[model samples]
Target: MRLCVPRAGDPATATAPVAVEVAAHLLGLVGDPATATVAWDIDWQGPLSVPLTDEHAVQAACGIMHVHGRAAGRPAPLAVDYASTVAGVLAAQGVCAALLARAGGADVTRVRTSVGQAALLALAQYLAAATADGDDPEGCPPSRADAGQELVPAACSFVSADGVCFELEALDAERWLDFWRLLGVDRADTGRGWRSFQQRFATATCALPPVLSATVRRASFTAVRSAADRAGATVLPVRQDPLPPTVTPPWTLTPFPEPGGTTIDRDGTAAAPLEGLRVVESARRVQGPLAGHVLRLLGADVVRIEPPGGDPMRGVPPMAGTTSARFSALNAGKAVTEIDFTTDAGRRAVRDLVSEADVFLHNWAPGKAVRLGLDADDLRAARPGLVYAWASGWGDALGPEPPVGTDYLVQAHSGLAAAVRPADEPPAPSLMTLTDVLGGLVCAQGVLAALLTRLHTGRGARVDSSLFSAAVLVPRGPGRPAATGRPLHTRDGYIALGPRARQRPERLAPALGLAASASADAIASRARTRPTAHWLPRLAAAGVAVTPVCTSLADLARDPRFAPALTVGEYAAPLAPWEFS
Candidate 1:
């Protein structure tokens, strides 16, 4: 979003006309939230990447740049206006919750959201790990080898001998070793590489042996595919052709009729939109659990069902008071109960919990639920009016036999990896778990919409959302020609120039003591002659919007702009990405 500059003289506002116009655009209404009715059963298509005034500011302050830049091995922001997209989805969530509240007999009126808070929510896990005590204090990227200036550490997305840049995924360690060994990698290197390769999903840093890339570079994509297939791994080429932009909602809410279903009745206004609602989440990883987390943020009493001894992610790394900070970031406020869902007893236990819950959500593999006799149908039968949400990875788009169906691989398949980088750059997926976070929000959106629909029809819904589906919501348009608003290198530090400053570089040229050639390079060159502090005031005085690039996660805590959205504790966490009035 740093690159998206609103035209000069165009105003930026988040509420009233802008908000009302967006609301109107969504519901075909000329009114505000107060009069919004569940009768419309409003289904959101999507908004174009908004030219938010705080886009880059939020990115810089919230450590999003640090995450993305580190992954790219450069100081970079997402090519897509990701924060604004998240903000838009979050806005839809708030509205849906409000609709649910009104339908529940509460006089709900207004809800609030911001790009800043959405930014925090996007990187909430990463920030938590940074703040949490961990063995790997210095997270990879900005690769420390080159003072963090080198290309991605020779792992992750790789180019085939035929020039096809592709992502390879292997969840099983033996499969990863099998694939690599097929390419004639030494037993020593493959063994070492697997250690970091397995940790990539958790740590977001895959510092593997360069021989892996060298091996892939020498092999044709056909060879690579053959090796993967033989070894039980998945390989997907990063698509250059963009997926057709999504014009429909990211989730599906299919309602089931209930002859004697009951509508919820509330006496007075509650603390939040999802107050009194009970959500039973039996989900693993980011997409499903993060959805539950967002529901928890909206005031749902979320009860997380885990296997006996709890989800193993609790011991992954980066501990915050003995729990995985990343895990706790998504699940901190939820109540948990252990159920060995692999067993008949455990499946029955889960069903019992679902019987008393308003919603039962999960992201189990394709037939795992059915194998256990606990698919959405089973749960909803146990609780007739239950909102059964399946936070899927493939969303039935890939037929019965789907590919890896995880975040990074989905980015490669969905064209997002190609979309997030410039045409000239390699198609590298950001290690920041973008798809998972967005998918989570998409699932939460479906759940809320289903709940709202239930208030009117008194029928529960089957809400399904997927990482692949969520990927399309972020449009792959021709973005800004140059990222002029990204952080520029100053003598002592980096600072970001905002829309006003970037759109009119000539206006900023004089501020930096440069002549008519106020190109991005010129500004950056001159910036390096002085410290970031030296130019910040000068740029501001010259009416060029400027803010420091918060390159460190710890720095964000001290940033006043970031303080409002965060809760400082054993690990840093973001507050609910909304405001209500």
Candidate 2:
């Protein structure tokens, strides 16, 4: 792919990841490079361009087509102010991309539509804010402009007319086009005479001409609008809810001085941002363990305290020589020890660990945690400065919902399963453990944020996260149910439709499907004819919903974008040991 290197004095100068402190913030739905698929397998170890694989290109193309389709619905000489419209679109796309990346979608069509709608929503909110703010709101704060600027509280909000709302003023079209180019969207119109000439010869996949992608997206939305108008329907505009205010942070951040006693190893890693901080991990399974992993990533020394039987996730599928890849993905790169917190001795061990620990992460049942003396009060009584992190299946600790949860169980419980299946077919839980991974990522962010808070305040606080809550948080959906019910699928279900409308019910049915009927069976039969790879692109063209079935962990490993998970279970150490100092 081609790249359009910014001029020497460009505002978004590339910097080390730590320089961009909230690098993870830039990575998700909130940032400009609003992406759909994360290219999870991409070698995240190095720079952006060298690893420009096919998956990255496909993902980028998908995002461009989606934006274009949305723009096609709009009228030409679009009344949208250039900067504001594009900014709105970028904001929406950022959230959509983050969702899509965190939870892989079923079909390409939904991916595109969801992304476009999300982009529109984000854009709408931004413009509404800008219009409310009387036009220019300090011309898009520097942090919003730069990919590398540290994203602290001061940088999170823009000065709005009413007060300080956590929204930005909108951007006009020309500036929007520039933003698109910076994000690597492809387009034919560069608008600048010789400037167009300059980027014409560049690689199409590397970096899109900002103006080009914007124009293309505008055209696509115009077409979509025209089609709707011809069908005798007025297009309804999309809107988004206000983002949650940063409250009750999960963890705190503490910048560390260079190590004086320990030997330094800075060859390829980011600076040890939390070199002297200590994190005590009591979490089992992915969500809580992953929080500790994130702390370790930022240079904190993480001490993982596993129960005697080890984490239950160790028994999860896709194991290698009896070890679970699922467990390894979240638990690697930390020092591990075994403890039994249920016993007084075990509780004492935990207290000793917490006395020197800056953060503590766990996923035990909430009430059980308190009964077992692992509650915030019990632990804090021993160590006041400790940041307690708790991840669970549901949201019982605070607002709505109760404990008793699992990743897949939560997917079925939280209406995520409802969203994934085809409208006509039996509900099928997602092939991937979305709640597990998404919750893990969020828990990690919470832990880090809480850490940052500890840096400012001498006191520590309890930070709680859960799969039930996170599932609701990450996926755009409705509020909690007054009373909970049993999860839908204790077993797997299927979704399929034959090429013809009248396929036999017997042929379409899964060998032993859950909640399958004759009608559902017919749908499944038709579904089988169109393998995931073939159906994804076709459904996108037809505007139908679909979900690609990933049969095995190996299938995912085969995809280059998923390489990080491949060596997850290979935890053996080198034969010869080396010294740190």
Candidate 3:
């Protein structure tokens, strides 16, 4: 379902709303009218590309606001006055707060409807505070007044790997209607207030707002389960053990050994633990390339040997000048080279690289490399000490569809879609590349562990990863089979409650007034009954393990704990001036 909100800037100018316009244009591409649902969340910090209208289109949309601070207060004192667009968004927020207070076992009519203009101003003040003193380390967008730039509404169209696309619209201001009124447009052409305008506006933007979807068919889920049953896929379950209350567990963020009493070198280069390591990567897209890239990050001299035309992912979305964002993210910090393995020269070059390399890695089918004469045996023959790693769709080294596998296919074949999608909705594919990223991480771990073994034993070992394996490894619903089981093994399943959910699901269930059968849906439905301010803190303090579902790497880029992954792209110049004295 499409979750969209109207976007407006301080003044609601025609040219300022390009992002929202682009979003609307993309929504126009979905075709059918009856198959979509629009949920609108208005922002109060940017300009708008599309003008607000009073038409029939917007009435059916679910409205929301991009607000800050308590949902109960009138507009708080702020340094600057927000646009009327922001006011409109706050109105929507107030409406929602009223609805939620009623739903969450609170008095309905007596519920304070304090989320009006005054509440919006209060939110603006909190936005200011959050920016100056609050905990938004991830660098969210700035309000127009703070940036000293024209505020325009922005929006984006997101398509999941499984081909489900949706539009998200963000406005810069909540007092949007006031600004429009100040513009003095003719009453002959326009309607009354902002609410009336929005109700009518929905009709013009979309007959039925788009419902973006990324889901798998139940039939596909059943089929894959059947095939896995035949092939013997393993299922691992969740740990239900309770933690001790008195003793605190020690956790370390550092992953490797540090040199004792060693200071930074004059040139600022840290000593490489695996300095002499040389790796040849035949990985193309994110999964395989990410493995090689990780090795490079850890001080291995990795050469990403691509096909004659380079990896196909180079043409994927988010291109920067000459490279795709995906490619840049995966292949950064590694040396890039091309070879046509089908050609004699290309094959010869790879063999030459392999001869000097300590590790040879690729994400290909089981025996295709052997047929192509680049298999482990062939490489081992040329270079005895080379560790070989291969990532596949399935782990057995051979299967019917041993051709190739991507994240989407794995989500379909594995029961992950069954876990993520809503019960009545079709099984939707996940937006995040959990399989690809996890498989890459696993592949790197395998290669490194094998390398350590090689150092001790003087012989190489083969490391393998499967999209199928990665899919099965991530935790799923409580009643489903644990991912650790043998192929086709059935067991009780449970959902992940995040880091804070350490109170044990069984314990938290009673406090939250939920029974064992209370599903994630029930929890989400209840959570929505209160304002974000009230719920987020309460959940955390109560040790309720919850996290946003289906967030992406782009989203994590703003997170402090996980920001390191986003920095991968900044290493384009390996030995740049910043690295030297």
Candidate 4:
């Protein structure tokens, strides 16, 4: 692949290639970079510019630091690279899809993605849901008042008596009672439902953690893990290690006669390659939904299959009316249906759906799909040429049969927590769900590749992505130097100064009223002498990449250009990072 490096002095130009590199690595084409090319000179900031006030910048920076609630007072840098990286991956996927389609006899060329677009997609669910104005507001859960309560009660970190921190995730509602029983909690006596259990533990303050920690300390990690497995719960010990990102070729390819279904029609429009493709999604949470969302943006007809009551995420916080802004952001532009897959009729209905689908995607824990008679083999049997995909938290090689794959647990296992930890501080997670977002991107990439291969071989393939692998793919190393340019405090707000400022201190110092010989701390002190408005123009005139940090999605939506990206119907949603031409 030939890289079109942006002109010197533009940091934003470097973002698009991150996705290409990732895709090339996955395709085993990194060694032959000349095979692909990028148009990197695209003006990214023009469509994404938003006004940034110093006060808003500081508040946004603080919002990122306090994402975990537990780290509210801590000084932590936002993982600013995440948005661009994810956008790059999405861009790469689009390119790959277009290339494959062209090779498969479709007329198409030139796929593009931007950091701004990627940032929007990465936070789509949150952004859409938060800005949505619904008539009937969903009631907040009782646990909402508790600062420590996570959305899923069972999927949080717990400390052991020995102070070892681990994560537990019991996603299967049926296994809820069993999990508590294994933890030695008797539901018969306590009469606690899942929500109540989460509420009690989350709000227990000093009471719950100690009891659980003491109890967990009595057993070895292996023993606890084994017990969890027997109870159908996923438990994993948090570790501090580096996990480099890597991708293997597709794992399973089964040849069978084509189902003779109609291929997705392009309608003579080369702009959307995957248009007319029908996707049946039986996935929950961010990973599968995000993947489906990407496919939808590529012009697929995505039909999401939710359980009888609807997706659990529909009830997650920051709701509008009866709708979850998070849910709307992820499921927008797709058809949705409620299905009770546990029933015989539900199974048959899904089987019929699969027969007509080009893709069948899910994130059901291992064995759950099989138990429900909806495993890859079953679905592929229904549609012989179906591109079957599964997203999980861990790869199959992990010792535990099915490890807990929640965002936090995957972050811990994949070494992200260790890598991003500030000196002398415990491991800190990125403010966003990095692994899930990346995993979704990887999953989409794999699915697109599988589709391309199917065009050639006339057969279906199984594509898999896990949070562990996604975590590994993230580039990690020593953080930027403390003295390196960073978000600087202004008398009334904050502004991000790029490292270019540090490299050109002669030009930057005067802009901030600092001497060229000033120390990093001295520069920051000088910056605080003026308000943001006074310095923003000077920094821009000097050709430094600077902006007021966005305090919230709402803040970003206020800008007209950004408003279009975030607004969807009555709700604000993230814009897809890629534009097909």
Candidate with best lDDT: 1
Q: Order the candidate numbers by lDDT, best to worst.
A: 1, 4, 3, 2
Please give the RMSD of candidate 4 to the true structure.
6.0
- Candidate 1 residue lDDT tens string, 19-51: 232333433211233335332111111121223
- TM-score comparison, 3 vs 4, better candidate: 4
Please give, for residues 1-581, the per-residue lDDT of candidate 4 as tens digits: 44445567664443344445554565552122322643322224325554322211322332332222222322234433454456556656766666544543576545555555665666665455436663222112343334353333222355555566676666654565575567676554222345443322111111122345456777667667776788787766665444433433323334445543334455654556676688999887788888898898777889999988888777764565576677766777789888898799999999999898889988888778889999888888888789888887776647557556677667777667666554444553543566777788778877877776676567887777777767777666654213333457788766665546646766677666566677777877888888888888888886765656544455555557675555556666666556555
RMSD of each: 5.4, 24.8, 24.1, 6.0
**Angstrom error at residue 579, model 2:** 26
List the candidate 1 regions with Cα displacement exceeding 4 Å: 1-52, 136-156, 244-248, 265-269, 478-485, 518-522
lDDT of 3 by residue, 281-356 (tens): 9876556886776566545689888887877766643344466543565576688789988888988899999887
Model 1 vs. true fold: TM: 0.88
Task: List TM-scores for all candidates, in order.
Answer: 0.88, 0.43, 0.45, 0.78
Residue-pair clashes per candidate = 1, 53, 76, 12
Local distance difference test, each candidate: 0.73, 0.38, 0.39, 0.60
Deviation (Å) of 102 in candidate 4: 3.9
Ranking by TM-score: 1, 4, 3, 2
Which 10 consecutive positions of candidate 3 have the poorest summed lDDT? Answer: 55-64
State the weakest 10-residue window (summed lDDT) of model 2.
572-581
Q: Report the C-alpha displacement of residue 280, candidate 4, in angstroms.
A: 0.7
Task: State the TM-score for model 4.
Answer: 0.78
lDDT of 3 at 190: 19
